[model samples]
Target: MRIEIVEGDITVRPVDAIVNAANSSLLGGGGVDGAIHRAAGPELLEACRELRATKLPDGLAVGAAVATPGFLLPAKWVIHTVGPNRHAGQTNPALLASCFTESLRIADGLGARSVAFPAVSAGVYGWDARKVAQLGIEAVRAYAGRPLEGEKPMVELVEFVLFSEETAGIFRQALEESGGGPG
Candidate 1:
C-alpha cells in the first residue's frame, strides 16, 4: 500500500473512505468527530447511536461505513472506528494501531481504492507525536501486505491527515528514517 502523510482537513477529502476520529461512545463528540458528524448531518448520529446500542466494548473496532448523504461531504462512506482515550499514560498504542488496521480491513473488503485517516488518538488520546506516527505507519505497513477480504491483494493507498505542520514533519521524518532502516 502507498502510505502518505499530509496536513489538511479530513472532512473535505474526496477519497472513497474517510476514518472518523470517533469517541468510544460513537455518539460523535468534539474535535474531528464533531466536525464529521456536523458535516455528515443528523442522520449520522442516528445511525451511530444504533451501532452503539449493541453494547460494543471500547476496544472493539468495526467498519463498510454508512453513507452520509453526498450533499455535504464528497466521500461515499465514513468508516467509523472507536479510538481509545488516553486519560493518563495507560493508553495502548497497539489498540490504536488496531483501529487503523481494522478500518483498512473493512475498506479493503468493500473494494475501496483510497482511504483518508486522521491522526488517530493523537489529538485527544495524548499519544506522543513521534510514537503515534510510528505506530500509524507500522499499522499501514502491515495492512499494506495483506489485502482486504475477497480482494486480489492490491496496494491500498492510505493518507494520514496531520492537523499541524509539526505532526506532518514528524511523520515524514519517521517514515523516511524507518523506510531506510528495515522497518
Candidate 2:
C-alpha cells in the first residue's frame, strides 16, 4: 500500500473513501465530525440518523466502523469510526489502532482504491500525538502486510490528512521510523 501524509481537510480529499474520526453517535459532533457533516450537507446527517435509528440504535462502539455515502463531499464514501476517547479513560492503544484497521477493512469491502484518514483520537480526545501517529501507521502497515486470499488488496492508497504541519511531521517521522518512508 502507498501511504501519503498530507496536511489539509479530509472532507476535500478526492479519494474513494474518507474516514471520519467520529463520535460514538455517528450523527456528528465537533472537530472533523462537524467539519465533514457541514461539508457533506444535511444528507450526511440524515444517513447517519437512519443508521442510528436502525442498526446502531445505541450508537457505534469505540474501535468499530461503518460506512455511509459521502453525500456532498469529494469522496465516494464516508467510513465513520469511533476512536477510543482517552479523556473518557479509554487509553488503550490497541483500541485506537482498531479504528484504523476497521476503517481500512471497510474501505476494502467497498473496493476503494484510496482512502483518506484523520489523526484519530489525537485531537480533542486528548491522546498523545506521537503515540497516535505511531499506532495509526503501524496498524495500517500491519494490515497491508497481510496477504489476502487469492486477490490483491482492494485499498492501495492510504492518505493521512492531518490538520497541521506539526501533526503531519509526527506521522511522517513515524512512517520513516517504520521503514515506510513518507510518501
Candidate 3:
C-alpha cells in the first residue's frame, strides 16, 4: 500500500474512488463539497437525495459513507463521508478519524484499488490543518500499509489532496517527522 499527499482537487482524481467531505444533509455546499458536486454533475445530487430519503441516523456523525456514481469524475465512484468540526472539541477526534476508517472500509468492500481524499474537515468544518494532518497521516498509515483481510485488491494508493500550499506543507512536515507516508 502507498499513501500520497498532494495539493490539488480531489474531485478530479482518476483513482477508483474519491472521498467527498460531505455534510449530514448531503446537499451541495461550498468549498470542496460544492466543487465535487459541480464536477460530478446533477446526477450525484439525485443520488444523494435518494439516499437521504432513507432516513439515516442523527448524530451518526463520521465514517458513515455512501457510494454514488462519479458522473463527470474520472473515478468510478464517489464516497461521501461527514467529518466533525473542531468546535465540537478534542473529544471529537475519533469522529473525524472514523471518516477515514469508514471511507476505507467502503472502498475495501467495493474492491477499490486506489482512493483520493480531501482534507475532510479543514474547510467549513473548521478543523486545524496541523491536527487534521497528524490524525489523517496516522489513519492512513494504520490502514494504507495493509490491505483488509489479507486480500490485496491491489489497494496500493491512498492520496490526501490538499487545496492550499500551507496545508500541503503541514501534511509534508507531518509525514516527514513521523517517517510515515508513501516513499
Candidate 4:
C-alpha cells in the first residue's frame, strides 16, 4: 500500500473510490458532502434516496460507512462515512479513527484499488486538524498492515486529498512521522 498527500478537491479525483465526510442523514449537507452531491448530479441524490428508503432509513451511524455510485464524477464509487462531531459531544478519537478504517473496509469490499479521502472531521465538525491528520494516517497505515476481508487488499494507493495546502501539510507531517513520505 502507498500513502499520498495532495491538496485538491476530493470530487475530481480519479481514484476507484472517494470517501465522503457525510452527515448521518447521508442526504447531503456542507463541505465535502455538498461538493460531492453537486458534482455527482441528481442521480447521486437518487441513489442516496434509495439507500435512505431501504437500507439506511434512520440514516447512517457515525463511524459507519456505505457506498453509492459516483455517478457523474470520475471515481467509480463513493464511500459515505459519518465523522464524529466534537461539538456534539462525540469527542472519542476511536470514532474518528473508525471513519478512516470503515471507509477503507468498504472500499476494499468494493474492489477499489485506489481511494481518495478528505480530512474526515477537520473542518466544520470542530476537530483539530492535527488530530484528524494523525488519526487518518494511523488508521490508513494500520489498514495497510492488515490482510483484506477476502483476497489481499487491492488498495494500491490511499491519498489524502485535502482542501488546502495547510491541511495537506498537516497530513504530510503525519505521514512522515509514521515513516511514510508523500507519494
What tens-digit string does per-residue lDDT give for candidate 2 at 113-171? 99999999997999988999899988998888773453667888999999999999998
lDDT of 4 by residue, 1-183 (tens): 889888999999989999999999998999999999999999988999999999999999999999999999999999999999999999999999999999988998889999999999888999999999999888888887785644677788999999999999888888888785853
lDDT values for all models: 0.72, 0.91, 0.81, 0.92
Off by over 4 Å in 3: 55-60, 88-91, 145-154, 180-183
Backbone clash numbers for all candidates listed: 0, 0, 0, 0
Error of 3 at 103 (Å): 0.3
* 134: Cα error in model 4, Å: 0.4
Model 1 TM-score (2 dp): 0.84
* Order of models, best TM-score first: 4, 2, 3, 1
Candidate 2 segments whose C-alpha is farther than 4 A from its true place: 147-151
lDDT of 3 by residue, 37-129 (tens): 999999999888877777653523565777888899899999899888766663478777788878887888888889998888886678888
**TM-score for predicted model 4 compared with the true structure:** 0.96
TM-score of every model?
0.84, 0.96, 0.89, 0.96
lDDT of 4: 0.92
Q: Tell me the tens digit of each residue's lDDT in model 1 across 1-23.
A: 67788888888887888888776
Clashing pairs in 4: none
Looking at candidate 4, what is the lDDT of residue 157?
Answer: 97
